[model samples]
Target: MECDASTIVSGFVEKVVSRYAESIDRDNVAPPEFFRDAAGHGVFGLPIPREYGGWGLPFSDFMDALRLIARESPSIAHIIFVHSMSAYFVEKFGSEEAREEILPGAARGERILALAFTEPGAGSDLASIETRAEKRGDTYVLEGEKLFTTNALYADTFIVLARTGPLEARHKALTLFALDKAEGVEVGEPLDLMGFRGTGLARVLLKGVEVPSSRVLGRENEGFKPAVVGLGVGRLPFASIALGIAEGALEEAVRWALERKSFGRPIFENQAVSFPLAEVAAEVEAVKALIRRTAELHDKGENILLHASIAKFLAARLAVKATRIAVQVMGGRGLLTASKVSRLYRDAKAAEIAEGTNEVQLMIIARDLAKRVR
Candidate 1:
């Protein structure tokens, strides 16, 4: 029997994933120990099938687990989000042999995976990527640089996108390959960003990296569908991270307002402070409903591109708004780098840009919306 959608992953999330919430965010380097601990507790195994040594919870349950992780540390949650893109692509398109080889170690956290697609010139555009792969007798040699790889610094393997056909072929020329970082692959230092710090974010330089034919994730030159599916799956959890940020911001702001007294009474008593909190609270709830609904649709195998974009777009914007409000309520104290409010503020902005930028999401939504209207 399949696992129930609820209660399957609560314990590990509550006990193990939340344990390093403070330290994970505070440390400059992401602690490898946290990944090991999370793996030992079976957090990584939740999404894998039972046949492959995983608990095999429903996708909705996986999304719910991500929400808990996000509440603790969206940085960690963001890392998992990128990993999901790799995991999903491998599971859906990789050979049975490859799945058997990769999924078990992945479930155990012995192996970490990341996707390398974006480049300096190609942020939202996938077809224009300059990375190219040349097919030889039995291997495909790849060479190029990928920017903004969330787990590149420590990932054991990368599912990279490279041009296999021709630039004139546009997106159809793109192919996905799961290549080991062992040979010909160089991982660069993490980018100094405003948020999602310590995610092992870095540039990946692939110089003549050779991939065995078997490591190709999907049909050669036909990876566009898988890439789109990965993005769709990603939007659900990415939105959840934004949701957690909004919720955490609301919690922090409310506490700060209720305690920090003003001229006559608590700051919360002042409409100037209280009104924004109330407004943000209402908005967060709306985003929460949409997020949950989106996840449920995803679990049902429904086409969720439009819904996912709506959720992500709203969640990112709302999270940033709420975090800013939290900082406002906390005043000077919120500006401190050490404060959770400050962290939330920074992470909220990052949410809008990662996965796909808010602008990209809007473009997708507008295009889809036009179809429905016509």
Candidate 2:
């Protein structure tokens, strides 16, 4: 049976997230206690195994929880997505020793995980990563820099992708290491982002950071696991977050249209205001259905690449559209920096770029379609 996460979601939102969300965005930083409080509510452990000190809920439930959190603060939800996705990688592919060492702390949110995948030269083209990990004895010395690493400021560990073989090997040359933030690991100052502001997004400099071969996730030289497995599983949950943003924006728009009167009657009564919101509402519902279906396919071990891409693509676009409409409906109030609708608009724009860009998603979908004819 699928566990419903609503109760936990409600409690966490009311007690821990609701009040501080605006401040977190305004300050462009979430307090340390916010994460701890989320941990206390089992927010971090929802999808981890019970044996690893997690609730072990289905992937769908975890996504549901994330969606609820996103409705209030997409920044916090983005943090959770990065942290949880990294944990998911470890739990699904890490060695027993690595799992035992990392999962428990991660499940408790005591040890935050940052995914160090993108580099200055390699964003969508992950196979072009230049980070090199030279094997020596039983350890590998890593030297590279990762950019836009979410959760970098608070990460206790980094799941880094580096080249382990010849450049000609391409995807086969890659390897993933669970490297601790020890000596030689430097996190740069967080970038001032237009949206998803409080996620601690920063660059990481790895200079001769050494770790045991045992720290390698999956087999050596197969770090493309993220592109093949990690992203397949990840896109749906990301779609769910976009869904939440759209839902939240749509709700705010409806409420504003109903309350804000223009020329006597409520603005909602006018077709001009209602039409756009209604269209956005329909698209939001469609995205929700797509996300749910993709999540179900994920849990069943089905091929979710195309479905996940389509869902993410549509949902992200919906988030942007919905937030734009919400802002339009609210007029000047929505433009204010302090307005929640304004904040959602900024975040929705970012959603289109994160979790794989809209263009990337279209490429995936198009390639999948092309494969059918051959």
Candidate 3:
């Protein structure tokens, strides 16, 4: 990492993040100023290359900042995820014209981007996607809807994954496009979600939306894994997010346990309360270890699909378990809307469903394992 972590945390996290996390979470919208300041500080491009006006941290180091941001405001962390992922995708797969147009401006916080991949009928089954972009002369016209498109409300650019060939073509027919919500595009209302609400989660409608032909990402009709897998997004990004949520919840539960007194003694002294918290803390450490290992493998340029799945799979479940424990430890305070644990619990539940469901991750892992077995 080029910039110091302590300084960013002091200036950004302590000064801005700590102050705004609650209000943003409550309102379900991160203010534009937050993005401006964060981008100015290079928080938006931690993993992006320096040539693109980013800090250019390795993936491992980027995880540290993501974890810190998540600990304070998971909703904002979600925003960071979308921003960094979109930037990285463009830097890796976008055409020179598209990259030059978007990345530099993105680092300046003047541009925001999101990936529109998941659909109402297509979550784990990316092949079933119905969104399509038909080519006509110099422009590609898009007509479809994207569900759970985070950051759509405020994003200036969107990298849409659409089907460009017959449905029977499956992965071979998939294509990636870089489009702007400049015209013929409609953004739905922000979802009142259980968690990650403030990150502008919403549905996007495209009715004959036109994008210049120069914006096509990667090669046409060959969008299987080449377009995204090389970036190591699902493994490190989602796993680190899970780690941050778990750590945040654990911190809250620990603080409450040690501070509140019961029966003229600290409630934390009770083995019943303390043991579970300890277990969650241990689980957090284990998840961190796994995430770090996967990150190291990623930096080494190893094929980390297996490691990523392992990390993403384990960390996701860990978030759910740790948050539930945190809420239980806080007792009645956890149930109150005013309590941070309440929000953490909700966020943790959302983690399991994001990226891919736990069952889907397991299938990937199990398939690989079975193939390698003697």
Candidate 4:
């Protein structure tokens, strides 16, 4: 039976959204209690199978949950999104032993996982990563540094991609390892970035980290395929998060516009103000539709790489525009740190950078289009 996306998860998400938003900004870290609450409520395991103690809900329901979380705290949503995406990868591709060992705890919110893909030498070019993993008996000795790893500080395990074969092989040479944060795994100091501050992004240094054979995800040298597939599915949640940020900014802008007076009249009454607000509203709705459609395409098992990239790119771009307009609408108060629009503005930029940058997405789309023409 298909899960009821709208009905089942909305209420739970609404109850926690505002609280998460407030604490996430104040703490500058994902509120540990919030994740525990979500896990207890079956949100962390939204996509995991019931056998693994997850709800195993349909992808639509997962999107709804993500939207709610994003509305409240985009950083928390982002952290959860990355971890859940990793969990999904493990559940889908990892061996039975791996699944049984990790899935239940992760689904229950007892564990957090991070994706370690971006390297100092390679950002958009995954094939250019210089991180190496050499087989040493039954274990792989890993050595490399991964940058911009979301949730690295909090993650108990990481899905690390390293070059397992000759560098010339590029995509075919890479392999994935489900590495634990043990002695050799060094999580660098948390980065203080301009946005998504609570996500705990950090540089991960893997120096001779020994991962057992059982820790390998999928077969050796076949990591790129699953990594790409996981990224495609992951983009939908990011698009939803962007939509939520834009919507939140819009709501704040409207509230401020209606209440704040200029020239002895409410600012919203001005055609100049109202027209831009209307434009933002329309753009937000369009983004929502795009995110939903892309998610549906993913659920249908269609090849949605181009569509995912499009949705992610457009949603991120629109979010930046909408949030900027929101700030403009609110004038001085919008620039204040305490203002909702202000936070939204910061969060909106992350959408453009995470999952994949807008530039990278455009390149992917253009490449796909060129192939079709050929």
Would you list the clashing residue pairs of candidate 1? none
lDDT of 4 by residue, 229-273 (tens): 889768878888888888878888898899999799999999999
Of the candidates shown, which would achieve the greatest TM-score relative to the real structure? 2
Worst 10 residues of 4 by lDDT: 1-10
lDDT of 1 at 195: 89
Off by over 4 Å in 4: 1-15
- With candidate 2 superimposed using the best TM-score fit, by how many Å does residue 87's alpha carbon deviate from the native? 0.5
Q: Compared with the true structure, what per-residue lDDT tens digits does model 1 show for residues 151-222?
A: 887798898889998888988888888888785689997788888887888999998988888988888999
**CA lDDT scores, all candidates in order:** 0.82, 0.87, 0.82, 0.83
Model 2: per-residue lDDT, tens digit, 18-73? 97789888888878888878888887777888899978877778778888888888
Q: 2 or 3, which is superior by lDDT?
A: 2
Put down candidate 3 lDDT per residue, 227-342, tens digits, no spaces.
44833355577778888989999999989999989999778999999998898889889889888887888788787887787888888898889889888888899889868888
TM-score of every model? Answer: 0.94, 0.97, 0.96, 0.94
Best by lDDT: 2
Predicted structure 4: lDDT: 0.83
Ranking by lDDT: 2, 4, 1, 3
- Which ranges in model 3 have alpha carbons more than 4 Å from their true place? 227-232
